[model samples]
Target chain A: MKMKCRQFFEEFGVTRMIAVGFFLAIAIAVPVLHLNTLTLYSQALTRMAMNGVLVLTMVPIMVCGAGMNFALPIGIICGLIGGLISMNMNLQGFTGFFASILFSLPFSLVMGYLYGLLMNRVKGSEMMIATYVGFAVISAMCIVWLFVPIDNLVLRMQMGRGLRKDVVLTDFWAGILDDLCPVTIGGLTIPLGTFLFLFLMCFLVYLYMHSKTGIMMRAAGQNPGLAAANGINVDRMRIWGITLSTVLGAIGILVYAQSYGFMQFYESPKMMSFSAVAAVLLGGASNKRASIFNVIFGVMVFQGILTLSMPVANVLLPESNISDIVRMIISNGIILYALGKGSGKK
Target chain B: MKTIKQFFSENLVVIFFALLCLGAYLIAGQAPYVVVSDLINRVMRNSILVLALIIPIMAGMGLNFGIVVGAMSAQAAIILITHWRMTGMAGIVVALLVCTVISVICGYLLGMLFNKTRGQEMITGMIAGYFGNGIYLLIFLVLFGTVIPFWDEELSIRSGIGIKDTLKMIDGMKGAMDNVWKLQLSQVLIAVFVLYTLYMAYCIVKRGRENRSAVKISVIKWLIWGAALAAVLLIPSVSAVVTRCKIPMITLFFVILVSVLCQFITSTKLGQDFRSVGMDIGIAEASGINVNRIRILATIFSTVIASWGQLAFLQNMGTFSTYTAQQNVGTFSIAALLVGGASIDKATVRQAFIGVVLFQLLFLLAPSAGTKIFNDTQVGEYFRTVISNGVIAVALVLHALNKNRKKAAQADSI
Candidate 1:
């Protein structure tokens, strides 16, 4: 029994253990702090579904050995462009949401290919370079956002030529997924449509991973030399992996924006990659290997902690952004732990 | 002509930035004196932080983004001294001592972490920086008034549970170094020239006694530098600008001291170890150098210097946003260093100084240039962000490409 317990701890990983422990702590704290448990659970579920795809974006890149997709803002920016175009054309509801995804596909594909090429060049230093690339793209887009030529008065700033910092989506596709088939039971609400969408993406990704191309990509990532010896075209596999991750990122942001009821521009997307990276890591993904299970499990625990911690922290501290502080701690702490684990070779 | 072309190609990054600075300056249409004074102030404030990056890069750590941890330590020290009501140079000294202790501890732990994440130190350091910030926030925000029993109306929020967003430095702490021994820019320049001549004369004499051939080269270099200084003084408009600006002598002295120290450290045995480790870990380890220990030492050195640099920076600024002040230190400093032509595996004090000037000059000019060209100040701010991040990204890509070429060349040769 003692040996089994030790073995379980060893295989569970410290990051996931801590994250699980923290999640449980927050879960217990919620009712004790006199917060609405049912409301918190509903919000947590909504958050999990909303951020699910973004967290899912990590698996392919990690599997294909490009490291964490720290340049998530690249795909995110592409999505924003697509969303802006759709909004400009005054598309609404599911049509608007899907149109945004469609418009974003071409951009994400091209950008992802180019980004993959860049990653191929900087083989070992992808994460650091990807981070700066993301930063550069975000800042460059700050200038681009100023003169995007989107004519929607609703999206654009009232007094300026630029888009507003937060473009409201109420008239468009706000809660389009969440409200699609929300189920309420015992005062707990479930965003069924969002969950279904998330699961669909997860299933597609799972199928792709089990396919021939996906297996080749994973083999290439696991050992590029061996894959190249086997004539696997490792570089191309990586590009495919990155392109797929970028597409998911673009889709993820649209889902996030719709659920949050606003599309945040400029610097807001800067740190989004870190949280997604952390969430995937928290769900038991290593530096070089991740899965659909990690995506689903990680988002739930990570976003659950985020949702539950806010009100609990507010109640405990009273008038402080202690929740943001906690978030910075937890997300970054998990990332640091995973990075320090040294490529998950064990 | 070939030599000139070689120089341009070799110094492409620096030359490119120099041109960008010149273009921005012209577009902004600022008075030379104003630009000169602002550049001087910025260089003095920021150069040390840029210089602090050199040791870690020498040790092959590739841009110590965890210097934010050092900056935080300095802030913590400053906050403590302010709370204690320590004032004047004594206060500054107390803060420095406190900062040194805290940063050394932080750097040591950071070094250990870097050891575990060897190949991915830069990204690890970046994440660790965020993690450190989280802990720092927790201390000031939650642990301070509640667990630690710290309280002051001015320092704490109204709820008395956390520190406020911005903290004003006590009057004596502000300008503590800059106000001491101020000199006109022209005077400072002439003084520096005289000092340079004296040093050159001593070098020549020593070399003459030794009958070394290098004395002539030293003399020629001295003459060229003297001529350059004379030409600047001889130009009436430049002279007027120089005379109009006041040099913070003490602050300038500290910056000079750091550069000299950096130069001196590189010639030492430990510096050679840093170079070997940075160049090739296997060879360095084979050669009996404890690569990990040396890397840790390099990190400690960097973190300590960065703490002092942040001290110099905050003292000059007088007021700082408590939570957000250290956020951009690593980014701006790394960007400045790279702009000066330093690479991931190599950096120099000269590059650090040059990068600080060029980076700060562009920063000073960009907004005005943006306002002039685009009629939007926000455009200029965005442009600055783009340039800073874009430069680093370009540098990283170029470095990676260079490494790939080198690796391919080796593979072909093999």
Candidate 2:
């Protein structure tokens, strides 16, 4: 019994245990605080589905050993540019949403290729370099957003010369996926379309992971020397992994914007990467390994905590943004824990 | 020509930034006096923070993004001191003492964290900063009035659960160092030149008594420096601007003191341990040095200095956005350090000084230059942000490339 308990603790990880404990605590608090359990559940579901794909972007990169995609903003920017172009052409509804995804593909691919090459060069220092690369791209886009010649009246800022900070997708495809076939039961609403879309992406990624190319990539990441000795082209596999991750990131942001009903430009995407990273880590993924289940579980728990904590914290300490503080603590705390664990090895 | 090429390649980042600053300054078209005075103030405010980043880098921990933690501890101390209504130099001293204690604890923990993360210290430190910010907010925002029993009419929000977002330093504490011994920039420069000449003469005399043949060379160097100082002082326009600009002598003294301490520490036994550990961790362990302890010590030194630097920055600013003041401390400092040509593995006081000046110069000119060029000040702001972040990215890439090249060369030699 003692050995089994030790094995359980070892396998489950202390960080994941703590995260699960926190999630359960928050889950219990929702009802004990006399908040609407149904409403919170619905919100949590919506959030989980919304952020699910973004969290999913972590798996391929981690498996192929590029570290956490801290340069997520690179793909995020590509997505934003695509979304903007779609809007510029005055596309709307499902057509607009899909068009945006299609538009972002090329940008993400090219950027991902270059990013992969950069990652190949930096090897051991990928995470740190990715972070600054994300930062540089975002800040550079801050200037580009000012001059991008996108003459869309709706997307352009009112009384100024640049894009609006928040571009509302209401007239376009806001909630096109989310409201497609939401299920209702006992006053709880589930965003079925969004979930379906999320699951589709996950399934595709799952299939890819089981493919020959994916196996080679994993082998390359696990032991580059051995992979190279076997003539597996380790560097090429890494680039493919990175490119796939970037492409998913581009799609993920579009999915997010549709549900959230706002394409937040400039600095908003800055912290998105951190939250996704923390979510995956919370779901029991390590620095060099992750999976589809990690994505699904992590997003649900993380977004659930976020959705539930707001109402609970507000009731407990009104007027203060204690929820945001909780978020920063939880997300960053999980990340720090994972990092301190050092590539999930003993 | 080869030497020139080597110099350019070595100092590429610095030269790029210097030229960018020049272009921005010309485009911005601000008066020299105004720009210089503003530059002086900014340099005074930010240089110490930039200097705080050196020890950890020297110890081979990369840029210590955990300095944000140090900045937070300093802010905590400052808040406490302000609440206690301590004023002037006494307040500053009390705050420094309190900050040192707080940051020592923070730094020790951060150092342990760095050890745990090892190769990924940079990202860990960045994430840790965010984590620390959350804890910081929890203390000030939630626990302050409710759990800790604190009440201040001016400092607290109306709901009274937490401190307000921005805290104005009580008048006496504001400019506590800057106002103590303010002097004209020209006066300060001349005084520095005179002191330098005296120090050189002392060196020459000592060397002469030791029968050193290098004494004449030293004398000539000292005379040339003196002549250069005199020549600069004689320039009418330069003198006008320098004389008009006020140097906060006490603040400048603090900057010099920190730089000298940094230089002095690098010559010590502990600093040698840091150098050895940085150069080769495996060899350092084999050589019987407590590599972990030295790393911890380096982190502690950096955190302590950063706390003091934050105290100086806050006192000079007079008012600070309580929650947000420390947010950019790490990024700006690291950016400035990198701008000065320091890498992840190497840095110097000279690089810190040059980086701070050039960074502040570009910062001052960016907005005006942006308005001139793009007709939008925000463009310039974004441009600078991009430049700072891009500079760090470029530096990292270059460092990585250089490391790979070295590794490949070693493999070939083998």
Candidate 3:
């Protein structure tokens, strides 16, 4: 009886630990909540909506068995370039949104294709190489950013420098889609427009993956050699998987930028991999599998923790990024623990 | 004539690195001589730390990304020691003890992680470092100041509950070791390097003599080298460097210990178990080896080393960019090791030294040189960062290509 009890505790201990973390967070938040419940609630919701799509992007890659998209840095850079071009072209309103998505697709596709090819060849070391390629691409893009001409006087550097790292998404399709159906209730504003678009994307992804091609992808992920033996072109499947993921990643960042209000560059997209990976991990996604549900749940819970940390601590402690620190610990700790499991069944 | 061709082909990596350096030097523009001197000195100072990355590669695990764990723990120890205001050698000694304990824990964890995922140990370890780095950030940033309530009004920000990014933790505690005997950078570099050389020489000498006494001498040489490395670490300078861009003497000792220990593992029966596990876990198990234990041990060693590396790096920088420190460290460091001519299935200590020197130099010079040549420092900086990433990409692609071809060839043979 005691042994079984010990085993049960060990099995569900992670859930308990997280529950404790939440408990502690609320304990600290009570006083702050009493003072400014209205303000805190709204802020938390805003953070969740902003970070949701980015978290969602981690799903397909995990499903395809490519592990966490540490290579997310690449997709982010592509999205940044895509967004910049759309704004610079002066495609106002819906045209700009479509244009940015259009502009980003080819780059994201090509990058993803190349990344997939490399991952296919590596067979086992995909995660690590994905990270390197991601960094390399970002680094290369940094150089390109300096040289990419910006003839738009408004878009050009203030001091005749190259494109500023943080370009305003205010112009063109800046918040066009985002503002479509924003709902303000109880002083908490929800970006219904973005949430809908994001939801639609998720639904499409879910439906598409439930088809035949997705089954092959899942198969390739589970046992590549077996899939190969069964005459499924594993490499091509991976390429397709990556292409879809990258496309989603491009959109993910766009949703993120529109909601967040600005596009920060250079190192801004650098740690996208870690964050996306972290969120998915929080949702109980592991190295080989994840779901859209995991993406949503993870982002909500993770961002909730992040949003609550600062004010709660600040009511007494004064620093705001305390939540960020906690978020970092939980995300990576989950990843580490997940990875440490001998079978890595998740 | 033969020599020239041999040099060009066989030493292509080195040749390319040298040419790149010269190109960077010309374009790097004029910095203050002192600053330039100081930077190079920093390069030399950190060389030992970088060199410590080699042995694990020799044992075929690629880059020791988890060495950051060891480095970080070492810095933590140093931080606590300095905070307590322990002076001179005593502080160094106690700090080392702390690093050792932290290293053991970190190493054991890394070793176990690597053990399970044997073939992809490098990537696994890289992630391990990133994960650990987050914990490090969380501890230093949030918990230390608020939850734990450790107080030193000087170190804490006006808004309590978080340690400042840069703490003058070692302000007066600087160069507490350098006062023992004045040592120049040349002497320090040369002395540390000679130990590596002597060990190599002893290896060669053992091969030549083939006598039992000669083998004994090799062991003695290792003992002597250990002593020498410790001496180099402890030599007192007139003024100690607190955030001075000098060599991290303490970090070097930790790396050396880890590397030697790794080398020892490879040379012993236990090492054989590790190698067998790497080659074929099933076969190793069948041969009565504890495969799981070996894998676990490998992971632990890697983790401890990583922590040590991180600790050293943090102390030297003396600041924390909580968000991104550990994110790409594994990739960059691994890229550097590869760029230095280390390969996946094969790597060596020499490769580690060469990689660190070349990679760091390129990293240093790229921004300056790229800017001067391209007339934009951002371009240079970006290019450098990208290239480090690119080199790894290229190396990995090459590895994949080679591995596939080799498999194809084997298939054909079969």
Best by DockQ: 2
Indicate the worst ten consecutive residues by lDDT in candidate 1 chain B.
B204-213
- For model 2, what is the C-alpha lDDT against the true structure? 0.91
User: Candidate 3, after superposition: displacement of residue B384 in Å?
Assistant: 2.8
Docking class of 3: acceptable
DockQ, per model, reads: 0.78, 0.79, 0.45
Query: What is the descending TM-score order?
Result: 2, 1, 3
User: Which segments of candidate 2 are over 4 A away from where they belong?
Assistant: A343-346, B208-220
Q: What is the per-residue lDDT of model 1 for residues A1-346, given as tens digits with 9 covering 90 to 100?
A: 9999999898777767877998999999998877899999999999999999999999999999999889999999999989999999999999999999999999999999999999999998899999999999999999999988876788888886899999999999999999999999999999999999999999999999999999999999888999999999999999999999999999999999999999999899999999999999888888789999988999989999888888988887888787788889989988888887854342
Q: Give the count of colliding residue pairs in each prediction.
A: 0, 0, 40
CAPRI grade of model 1: medium
Better of 2 and 3 by TM-score: 2
True contacts kept of each: 0.83, 0.82, 0.61
> Which run of 10 residues does model 3 chain A get worst, by summed lDDT?
A337-346
Q: Which stretches of candidate 1 lie over 4 Å from their true place?
A: A344-346, B208-228
Q: What is the lDDT of residue B87 in candidate 3?
A: 61
Query: lDDT order of candidates, best first?
Result: 1, 2, 3
